[model samples]
Target: MSPNRATTIAIGVGAVLLTSVAGYAVWFDYRRQTDKDFRRKIRKQNKKVSKVVEAENSAKGARTQQDLISAIIEISQEPTPTTPEESEKYFMENVAIGEKLSTLGPDAYVHAATSFYRALRIYPAPAELMQIYEKTVLPPVFAIVKELIGIANVIAQQSSRPAEAGIDGGEGEEDEEAMIAALQAAVAGAGRE
Candidate 1:
């Protein structure tokens, strides 16, 4: 090849190499930023869930008569769920607590449920705790008990679907259900025992 042609080809190759390196740097920077953002989001979610778990745990330890009574009074005196919407709100919150309590050890479940039952005694009216007991407490407890259950039903019906699905089924499924059932049955059977 001619000298001029060789120099032009070399210059073209150099430009392509420079462009490739620049593209890679941009991609690496974007990947790093994305990872950092993802980690930050996870940390935030963990903090929120952890706070709720901690509150449930603290509630578990308050077993004394006065302590239990105080919580009951607080729940009872709180404005009764005046509307269906408000009742639903309370019920959903209870569901979350129930799901968490179901995963705690036997003692934790006993304490949590005992606290729940005592709180119910204070606010047994259909207004708050009773409604929640029926709505939130029972269903998740049942779900916690029955792992063979489905999520949206359709997803479960998909013949090719996985053996496990969603939050209800995964690595934590067995342990979570066992813990929840043990706590529930223990607290439930306490009066009989």
Candidate 2:
């Protein structure tokens, strides 16, 4: 095109880029100045680490006890959706809530675990979901979730076996007991760490 037209286009593009950069700088500066939690944000440039991270580690350290049993029980008591579509939606929401709560601190672990457990209950393939949890969930939270699953399995075994039909369920009970014991040991070891 003409020289003047090319110059005008280049100037327009440069002005647009410059304005966008200035807008971002103002936003970043305002947040850095006014947002209290901004200082604790985890970034390459962030110097101060948040207490939430410390609290999460401490929470993992303090998971030696059986307090999570009550949280699991409470989660089980909460109403769950019956339909498949509703269950899917519920599962997504709980997982999101669990992830959000996980970043908060130690105090939120129980609530986070509760949310995860709720989602786990409605999942189509619980074992698969649990495997995913083992990889992605916090160690302490995963331990609690494993314990919850162990308890659920034991309960399922008990109900299906019944008091009189104890013949077929013996192996299941043995396996469940072993799993529960292993989970308990793992949790205790995590606390020692």
Candidate 3:
């Protein structure tokens, strides 16, 4: 075929494709503007997808909460450092590990928090160390550590109460029970948010 003839055929094909595309666009726009059933179907589909996404997120959230609770419980159950030298060394190791893990990102937050909780247990003064953590630690990790401390306190109180009751002839039992109740409330409140 001649060059002019080929060029004419190409332009004709191009024009046909463009016209078809523009015609489809106009039809789509008109359907969207005037078709109530079509619009409602789209909305329903979107709502369905949104509900599924919400369900999945809620499932993930439930798992995360359970994991946090289990981690706190496990850390509370672990044996503690017995001697001053052992306590200091354990504290330093855990603090260093926690600090390093905290930098690795969100997926490592639980491990980091557990490490910090371990160090806090052996620290010479936990309240002061916590103040330092507040300044230096990531917020999520800090929150986890805080929850662990509360739950550990509850566990510690429960264990000691039995022994102390035996020793004190049951004196101050009410105060002990009240303190346990208060710590439980704090732990529950912290987990809510």
Candidate 4:
């Protein structure tokens, strides 16, 4: 074969090899990213499932509000910590329980609020711990309190509204206002403490 032809063939082969390598590299990178994303998604889903299961398990034995309250009180009464780290750990656990209880239903709101309150009560008075509590813990606790108040208001309204004509208007409005005020006071107290 002519030298030019041989050179041309060699060039073509080299080009094909380079192109194939580049294509394979791109494919491999894409697959890697896809796999990473899939794994992340699966992990997120598993976390959600585990949380749901935990909530269910926690709720399984407590059939009544009194039982739930007793359980929460038991949790709150567990040994207090002397160190900030232990305090923070317990605070987080209580907050998590409160969050889970908040999801159960409006009936559980009191227990949820109590849990949050216990966390606040146990929180260390140090500057750093206070800051962390204010930043990470306060918002959710306040939110739960507000939610509880709202639910109470709704329940009061539903119950107080007359079902039939000429029925006496129940003590709905006053009770709702009182509950809201009490909740607000509790939240304020928690913030102060």
Instruction: Score candidate 1 by TM-score against the native.
Output: 0.28
Instruction: State the C-alpha lDDT per candidate.
Output: 0.49, 0.71, 0.78, 0.59
Candidate 2: list runs displaced more than 4 Å: 1-66, 155-193
Winner on TM-score between 2 and 3 is 3
- Candidate that beats the other on TM-score, 1 or 4, i.e. the better one: 4
Error of 4 at 21 (Å): 78
Ranking by TM-score: 3, 2, 4, 1
lDDT of 2 at 16: 100
Q: Write model 3 residue lDDT over 113-149, tens digit each, in one string.
A: 9899889877888899999999999999999888677
Candidate 4 matches the true fold with a TM-score of 0.29
Error of 2 at 148 (Å): 1.7
Model 1 alpha-carbon miss at residue 188, Å:
20
Better of 2 and 4 by TM-score: 2
Candidate 4: misplaced stretches above 4 Å? 1-78, 125-193
The sequence of per-residue lDDT tens digits that candidate 4 reaches over residues 1-193 is: 9999999999999999999999999987787677987678767999999999988876752333233333443543477878988888988887899778877876676677767656766765534544554565445445554443343344344335534222243357675445434434443444465
**Which residues of candidate 3, in runs, are more than 4 Å off?**
1-35, 153-193
Q: Which pairs clash (backbone N, Cα, C closer than 3 Å) in model 2?
A: none
Give residue 25's lDDT in candidate 2 (0 to 100). 95
Candidate 3, run of 10 with poorest lDDT: 162-171
Of the two candidates 1 and 2, the one with more favorable TM-score, higher being better, is 2
